[model samples]
Target: MRKLLGIIFLLYGYPAFAQADTTQYRVAGRKNLPENYGRPYVILISADGFRYDYATKYNAVNLLKLSAGGVASKGMIPSYPSNTFPNHYTLVTGMYPSTHGLVDNSFYDPHRDATYNMGNKAMVNDSSWYGGLPLWGLAEKNGLVSASLFWVASESRVAGIPPTYHYKYHNEFSNDRKVEIVKEWLQLPEAERPHLITLYFPEVDSQGHYYGPDARETEAAVHQVDEAIGKLVAEVSKLGLPDVNFVFVSDHGMLLSDVDHPIPVPELVSNRKFVVINSYSLVRIHALNPEQVRPVYRQLKKERNKDYKVYLTRHFPKRLHFRTNADDRIGDILLVPRAPKVFGSNPPSKRKYPGAHGYDPKKVPEMKATFMAWGPAFKPGKVIGTFENIHVYPLVAKILDLPVTHLIDGRSKVLGKTLKSP
Candidate 1:
């Protein structure tokens, strides 16, 4: 028994003789370090499709308590084309889809001669489609261990390194199982334990899509997720890790789909050569002939009504911070539909979900997501105004004390108000 314990201690950097006093032993190289040697530990959680108002609307008691005890935001506006994959990556990289190369949930890259889609596991695991360093990669490079419970891009080797510990995404895992995994990681020896962690919950988003955002099913999902959060908090407290910081956010909110008002894609463009990437709330029209771009834009513009609007990517509104790159993956022409309306090649009967996202964050109230933080690093009882989701990465980098090694659209100063001095 003694020999086995010694081997375990050697491998994990624990003090073998004093197993009961696990808290006194530091990491291998971090012994005798000052109190402020490293940044506060962080656990970033994403409740997929949890809208900004869900806390109040569903009476998520745990979420409300978290908000009142820490920093809360009125809303977190997602980047343009507010979808799951793009916005989730934006939250970690602090770059817009245009900059990060994840232009949409699915896109065709002419340079790579490849089509990338979220459902394609090979494409998702391939690092060729991802641009910039994710938080886990950055943390690993800086000598901090990181873990992910199904965060976007964490399963792949970004910046040439995956998270120190991670699992392949499987929505079948129950929330209790996921929380237990997180607790196990937290219980590891100091050297092997992750300093940065991310947890993703997709139940709220899934329920919203199936039953509509305002349905009782969606409200029940919100309640269930809140209870899970409470359980996680209790576990953390039981472990006595008081220094751990927590950030809760969602990629985008849900809007009801108007089955009666599907935009007629075939009527808008008779050209068969045009590639239409329809994502319900937004549509990207790729013209085979560059000359057809303007004509397609004009035809779509003629059909524009209160339900939708059309624009040439080159002339896309500067306020959107989109179309900044000449080689952007976005199509030549953009089609943005108003809330409850959608753009698709097929009729509404073929569509599956009653709720959808990927709309203009500024114009649609339903597309705004949630952002809340609690820990020693953040100020208590502070309510911040709405801000863009891209800014989240900088705040995370700041919390981890990671150097800004790459270009990102987020400015840390924008979120500085949420933090208290260390």
Candidate 2:
């Protein structure tokens, strides 16, 4: 990894942060913001657990409109585990789960000496808990106002600065309210305008978790959210904001799971019980009782169960690139399920549905999501084909002419291959 970083540095010049100071940071896509021009806003909307197939099946017209008329990828290639926060952070920072430091949906925060879950805004939004900067923070530093509707960690004060307008997590509200708030934020005047904006809808993911990936419930949730997206786009288009862009994407796809797929660790090792933890990429187990450690370790090594695969901390696959040092955020022992199987929070009797991610990155569909963009600044009806999530940050940077930062793991490419370069 050190060697790779050295090579990257040699090829790309210094990391974007190597040259700057206290000037409010500006992200790469907002250089068009002017005293006279309204801020060049980019609206990023994440439809959680929304599959590409469902998008068309449910007639997500707004999404398809953006994809058909703008630069859209066939789909996005996500980092492993494909859970929410890790993938969301990946979208904003352009780094994989391993590099950006938010490896899973849940993990023990050693610095604070507490367990943090992605669903808890208080824990996930704490700036100290995060290692990378979201695009809004960079925009704020560079003298542009930014806002977030539901993106996690958007509430934190990065480098002691917060977005000009922000609403903390409020999942209880109706989708109408979420749309209203976003419309209001977009309606702000030039001086008060948010140069960058982000929003998320977890209803689909919630449904997918409760009722397998292809369930009618999940499809309804997808359609409901698609209507909300349509509303947002219609509102934005009405505003006549110039040089605007909208990035529509999902964190990752979901996989169906069943109780029959459980690989019983306890059965493998006598008298040892593992503490299974919730995370985005890897299934982590902590040995609560020291006496159980050896038995559990032996069971994990000797067992050849088929539902999921276990790996010693040191031997986790090369693609995940998980840092397993004692102090690292991942767990002592990692478990990853094979395709179509998932890790559940609760045991089977009460388990209602089957769907999980955090699988191997090499898992074809699990690692692929979606990315589409449309705006006056971006070329229309273009297809960038498949792309890694990390490239998003650098592409945004290049579009905005902002100084690049080392925290990013993405690179820029000609996103609009079908349209003439402006």
> Best candidate per TM-score, number?
1
Q: Which pairs clash (backbone N, Cα, C closer than 3 Å) in model 1?
A: none
Candidate 1 lDDT, tens digit per residue, 228-314? 999998888788775889999999999988856676665655456777777777777778778988776776677556677788887
Where model 2 places Cα greater than 4 Å from the true spot, the runs are: 1-39, 110-112, 267-281, 286-298, 324-327, 344-349, 414-422
Candidate number of the best lDDT: 1
| Per-candidate clashes, comma-separated | 0, 15
Kindly list the per-residue Cα lDDT of model 2 for residues 269-345, writing each as its tens digit: 32335456644235676655557656676777677667667776667776666745334667667777666655543
Task: List runs of model 1 lying over 4 Å from the truth.
Answer: 1-38, 268-272, 303-306, 345-352
Q: Alpha-carbon error at 321 in model 1, in Å? A: 1.6
Q: After best superposition, candidate 2 residue 383: deviation in angstroms?
A: 2.5
Q: How far in Å is the alpha carbon of 153 misplaced in model 2?
A: 0.3
lDDT of 1: 0.80
